[model samples]
Target: MLRKITSLLLVGLLLVGLLAGCGAKPEEPQTEEPAKEEALKIAMVTDVGGVNDKSFNQSAWEGLQKAENELGVKPGYQESKQEADYSSNLELLTDAGNDLVWGIGFLMGSQVEQAAKDYPEQKFAIIDNYYENPSENLLGITFKEQEASFLVGYIAGKMTKTNKVGFIGGMDFAVIHRFDYGFKAGVKHANPDAEILSQYAGAFDKPAIGRSIAESMYAKDADIIFHAAGDTGNGMIEVAKEKGKYAIGVDKDQNPDAPENVITSAVKRVDNAIYNVAKDLKEGNFKGGTNITYGLAEGGVDIAPSSDKLVPKEILDEVAKLKEQIIAGEIKVPANKEEFEAMK
Candidate 1:
């Protein structure tokens, strides 16, 4: 009887061990990690004026920054120290596999075109320039700078205390010519008796040259000066402050640079253009191989709202009417010296 009882206990222990083994969980199979989406890269190559030109180049960078802040894009830029640096800088950005690269000024048009051809798979854009037959990957961005320049010129014509106002330009290129002629037209329209003084610094980076030009203009009894010179215009503003005269700024609102001296600014909305293009790219609706011109009607260019700080309300009211006329195509502003001469 004792042997039979021990055998029964052993059988019962074996049954309990089998039941525990059956209740154990099986091992789980492994899974690969999910892939993350890649970020879109955008970049620009600045002209010889450099990135902080406080005018054209600065405005373009501001636009790119806006896109970066609002569109989640990886934005970058290469500042060209000299004209020769444009191609290399653009090449560097292109080789980095950026989703889009921009050439900041018309001065880089040929270089940008060459880069676009060399890197057919990459996309490119240029500001203030257009090609006759561009590659499918290149987009041209232009603004009606003349429209905005005319408005400010009108103000200078009406507000000049000495009946003489001055216009200073950079490089004397077709682009700068637009600013020069438009201002002349506006001045002629507003004050027929006003004498307009014009000069070209032949360089956009030399402030000393700009200062000397401004001094000469002021000494000749010119009461107001409008400059389309990039960083060089900053010198004209400084001279205006010292002489207690007024200066009309360009590209961006420069009143903050010298509140007492800057009566107004001709604002070209390069920032808006940059933001729009980036948004279109993000939405996969980008239209390459085409030139788009932004004008007063498109809100691409206009006088700074801060004009009210120094510009009389009556003058502002007149400018507003002229703006509408420009937008409506009633007032044709000249884009070149030939057209201006014909209009006169």
Candidate 2:
């Protein structure tokens, strides 16, 4: 009985030791699952000009595409066929739970306004428009269009052999007026003797009307024609090409399509603005309920040097000086007829 007791005690000690050894073994390393990435959803609604219009619509879409490739955003877009489609198009993106939606033109001011009021939970942005009292969720993006137009107008002033230049506008809206005013200022700055004439297409998408108006201007001895008529501007450019005269393109470079005719383009950098806004949202720094104006100083607007013929170095040097002056607040480009007259 004594031997059995001793053996039992020894066995119990061994079992306890084995149990402790088992318990002391380190647990299998547990890996924390990699944190899931947040979704990036950004969308844009095109004005009547569509994504390929190569104007504001195309410019805005380019920005969204850029954000998609560089920022890892899944971008969406809906093209509007007419003015009536703005709200529904905006709703399409918002209904799909997009993080942000953008409207490309000022023509949709009322539509976006109503939509913003109706969908307070959704964030919204509109280009080429300024709202006096925007909703907390709405962003008003207006460019210093005059600043950019001035540069191009100066170019036109220096390059016009006819000593006569023209401007064809779309819709005669405040935005178009701003462009016209800045362009006139630039032309006057460069060549005070140059004659300036302007007319409106009465529609943003009417190319035939633009061509007809441009034809009249050209016949009237206006050799250099600048257009801010969205899709209609394309027709104006075609007229310039047909006449073998010069055309200053808008929004984006038209040199790729008509290098021979397109002397230069007044670029709005809509793509950059749109992309930056999306980037801000992704970085958690989007500023809403404010009017953000990007001008020559901000690299938001300028004349594209995408032509077959190079600008004279003297002309370029002069333009650079003017640009510097504008940035330094030594110059203020006008946005209206009254303001332009005051500049004189």
> Candidate 2: where is the Cα deviation over 4 Å?
1-32
For model 1, residues 1-344, the per-residue Cα lDDT tens digits are: 99999999999999999998899888889898899767789999998888898898999999999998998888999999899999999999988989999999989999999999999999999999978888889999998889999999999999999999999999878889889999999999999999999999988888888899999999999999999999888899999999899999999999999998899998999889888999999899777888989999999999998999999999999999999999888999999988998988
| TM-score of each prediction | 0.93, 0.90
Weakest ten-residue segment in model 1 by summed lDDT = 32-41
What is candidate 2's lDDT per residue for 97-174, written digit by digit as tens? 988988889999888878889999888999998999999888989888899899989999999999999999998789
Model 1 clashing-pair count:
0
Q: Note the residue pairs that clash in candidate 2.
A: none
Best-fitting candidate, scored by TM-score: 1
**Residue 35 Cα positional deviation in candidate 2, in Å, after optimal superposition:** 3.6
- Model 2 error, position 162 (Å): 1.5
